[model samples]
Target: MDLAVAHILSRVDVQGADVLLIDGPSGAGKSTLADAIVENWPAAEKPTLIRMDDIYPGWGGLAAAGEHVRTRVLEPRSLNQNARWQRHDWTLDAPAEWHDVPSALPLLVEGCGVLTRASAALATVTVWLDADDAVRKERALARDDGAFDAHWDDWDQQFARFVRDEDPVSSAKLVLRAS
Candidate 1:
């Protein structure tokens, strides 16, 4: 973990990356890594963080969330345009309020579907994280308590399809192991 954090910080320092995308399978610690980066960010003005988890409309929205991040967020931001994205209200299972993102601030997006080819092109840095299936499943279940219990198999299926179709790992500039 420390080495990963140091490597990310070094990337930011050397590359002057303004948009960092951390992506991987669920329970691979993408969110935890994002938190660490933000906490230790060198810049006084921290990057704005967005999680794909918030964009997923439901259990099967992995692909949709990835597209949304590419088109609505990364593309616009790359062109120096303000962007807005709608969040999925998980409890209500509906689209929620829009969140505005300015291109002026640095951005950090982290979650399961974030490292697609198109999205990677827009990001200044892209990371792929992974872990053994058993470890990942255990961590994911514990992290979400019982909310994700019923959807485990279904979500894993969707993720598998995403991996096969998008091959997001190929788009990553940096790859890390979570456990």
Candidate 2:
């Protein structure tokens, strides 16, 4: 996490990065890394942080959420326009209220499926994080407190497809390993 923060700070300082994307397999520490980055951000104004968990419509919404961020958030921000996104109410299994992100400030998005080639191109910094499969599965299942138990295999298959089709690891500017 310290190394990731240092790398991101370096990019922000040297490249004037206004958009940062951190992506990884489930439970690979994307959320943890994002939290660290936000806490240690060097800028006077912190970037807006959005988690892909909020954007995903359901267990199978990874690819769709990625596209949503690309078209609604990253693309608009790249054009210097305000970005808007609708959160997914997981409990109700329906779309929820809209949220807006200011384009004038920096943005940090951390999630699976957010670091595809197109999205990476729009981002100032992109990261790919990975962990051992056993570790990731254990962490994810435990984090959700058995709520994700039923959907684990399904989610894994979908994420596998996303990884295969989008090749996020190759698209990322930085690739980090986590426990």
Candidate 3:
């Protein structure tokens, strides 16, 4: 996996195309690859990791506000009106960000729906990782520490819906398997 990444990096000599998206299903090692790639890149070209989760408001954040708009609301409304929509809140009731999207570029968006039509249209390259369902479930379980069984189940369902609705894998530039 590491060597594969190195090969891709070496061959992709696009100057100033700093953004390289890493996308995949849950537990497909998007984070693992992102970390390794950034770590492996030269200091001048080292990529800064921008997790979609960080840009998003967590359950705790939205639970309290109830009706508040997310910080990222304006960015999408003005940037693109058709982004894939996802908004949720917790007991705190704060409103999480949502978008339904249009193409935007020069930045790598790594996560479940990062490679969808909106992103892929603008991306220079997208890395899609794959693993068997059993492996994916096992990795997901280990990563969540058994604390989000119900949430995980719900997430799985959501991922299915997202994939069915927007098949990002077909558009990826590269398909990789973590194991």
Q: lDDT: which candidate is best?
A: 2
lDDT of each residue in 24-135, candidate 2, tens digit only: 9898999999999888887678888999999998988999999999999999988888789999999999999999998777789999889989999998889999999999
Which 10 consecutive positions of candidate 3 have the poorest summed lDDT?
A: 62-71
Write one digit per residue (lDDT tens) for candidate 1, span 45-95: 788889999999999999999999889998988777879899999999999
User: Candidate 2: lDDT over CA atoms?
Assistant: 0.89
lDDT of 1: 0.88
Instruction: For model 2, give the 10-residue run with minimal summed lDDT.
Output: 8-17
Question: What lDDT is obtained when candidate 3 is compared to the true structure?
Answer: 0.57
Clashes of each: 0, 0, 14
TM-score of 1: 0.96
- The residue-by-residue lDDT of candidate 3 on 1-179, one tens digit each, is 67866865774543444446666767888878777766666546454454554333452331111112112322343345433434444334344555433323223456665556555555567778878888888887798777545666666776676667667688778888877
Candidate 1, which segments miss by more than 4 Å at Cα?
A: 13-17
In order, the Cα lDDT scores of the candidates are 0.88, 0.89, 0.57
Candidate 2 lDDT at 44 equals 76
lDDT at residue 123 of model 1 (Cα atoms): 82
